[model samples]
Target: MTVASLEYNGKPVVAEELTPEAFKKFGYVISPKDQAPKIPEGTYGMAYRLSDASIPVNNYGNSEFKTEAPCAFNLQRFKPPKALDRENKVYNLPNVERHPYTTQTFFPMGVDAEKAAYLVVVCENDENKLPDLSTLRVFVARGNQSVTYGAAVWHGGTCSLIDQLDMTMFMYDNGVKADEVHLVETSGLRIEYHL
Candidate 1:
């Protein structure tokens, strides 16, 4: 329906550093920084293992969507939020969405890790499969980091802070009703970030 119809606990969220352990239950923080090298120091020595946790899941089974292209690898661009309060480094969240049948991933392209960042707001589902505001969490992700939203996880609109972010995105879709969006009526839901 409309954002005015949703319920939100009126409190702003201060974003914290994203880490694998902290984000494990929701999804993951994908990055190459601060990890021991996993490959032998020879041919593929440059490879530092990040994660293999992004395997797609079809909770509703794969037979629901009938289409030629079930998955898409796309190059996309995201600008700073229209609702961003740059001087205050805050972004007002209007809504959240979820892909109930597949995971979503974004890889930042040519982003300067030191200069720009983005906000990722997530919450767990309630017994009725609605956004549980009490469990909401916000994370500040650097340009060096990427993220994969686990299947059926609820997340606020992706907002790039400071500068535009170009990315490669991957997701499964047949252009149907499996993608869900909940309009948030919570007036104070926001992300407070550090510039």
Candidate 2:
């Protein structure tokens, strides 16, 4: 079997289309069919539960789980990389991060219907508890769907393929420091995605 490398100078890994089965290791894919709302005859609506208490309390301890505060919800806007303006080729991947104690979700919104696709990069941890660079995978997500990252899974920041993109993010925290660990130094790797 051939191994994969993350670094890119010009030629980069082409991103694959996002799918539920392909993204299982990273987290849950929130689709209309899987997230249909339970309602009465006269009601019209849909719901998608992002995360739950099913996440294990590992390093944060039991006290961290006892907080009565609700999860934080915020809108995040992403801008396309400058490189795209010059050569419509690839987006550089400088860093990746993970939330050790809680699941994180993002719902895309306010996207131009004609160009609403975005990119997501992820990798699984190796035996040494560091990101397995060879396992890095890229995905293109549509605006109609939401994604929930599993606790402690490595993932890059949100990116857009078009000029501007907005997304609603949900996660447990004080909404201050963004409880996450950057894996760039530990993994010592970088990557790029083909446009």
Candidate 3:
């Protein structure tokens, strides 16, 4: 796992030069609507809601993103403390509970789209430091203020600092929603963090 820290002092975060051609094998695609389109396959799409009441604008390019309800807040970096059991060794499913379908909006690419991807942007408001993920490659912005991942890049869930962070993300590859979410018991199946 690699860890990088991004500090902010009222400066803009510049996008890194990530060309689609460089990640062709990983299914990269450029969205026509994006001025700097470099969508990666099977990745998450991160964007601030344009229609938010707190920050609304008519223009797509220059408009400010609004942070409002139906939003996900206060998330931590996702890192599996241990690995799962092998396929054959598994039997019944793990404790699978259905959480409420959140009203929060997330960027979703065509799961069936030949080239799918997902993305997450690290934009914190209070100058909080970013977390580290094991074996994950994060293409950070020039100033280390933020970063966007490519398609199908293996990752964990929400861990954003601020409510509104301007970002262009993509989701790629096939998806699944099975009845059971399984996890096999292992020695180091837990991760401890100090807040």
The digit string of per-residue lDDT tens for model 3 on 78-194 reads 221122122221111111111111111223322222221222222111222232122122121111222223222222333222222333232211122221111112121122111
Q: What is the lDDT for 123 in model 2?
A: 86
Per-prediction TM-score, please?
A: 0.83, 0.69, 0.22
lDDT of each: 0.72, 0.63, 0.24
Candidate 1, superposed: residue stretches over 4 Å from native: 1-4, 36-47, 50-53, 60-69, 178-186
Best by TM-score: 1
Q: Which residue pairs clash in candidate 2? A: none
Best by lDDT: 1
* Best-first order by lDDT: 1, 2, 3
Residue lDDT tens for model 2, 97-134: 77776678888886543343677788888796566767
Tens digits of per-residue lDDT for model 1, 1-195: 332336556667778777667788888677666344545656654465445645655454553555533677889888887888988888878778777767788888888865457788889988988778878888877787878888878887678884778888887765665343334455567668773
| Candidate numbers, best TM-score first, in rank order | 1, 2, 3
Looking at model 2, residue 46 earns an lDDT score of: 48
Which pairs clash inside model 1? none
Higher-ranked by TM-score: 1 or 2:
1
**Per-residue lDDT value at 186 in model 1:** 56
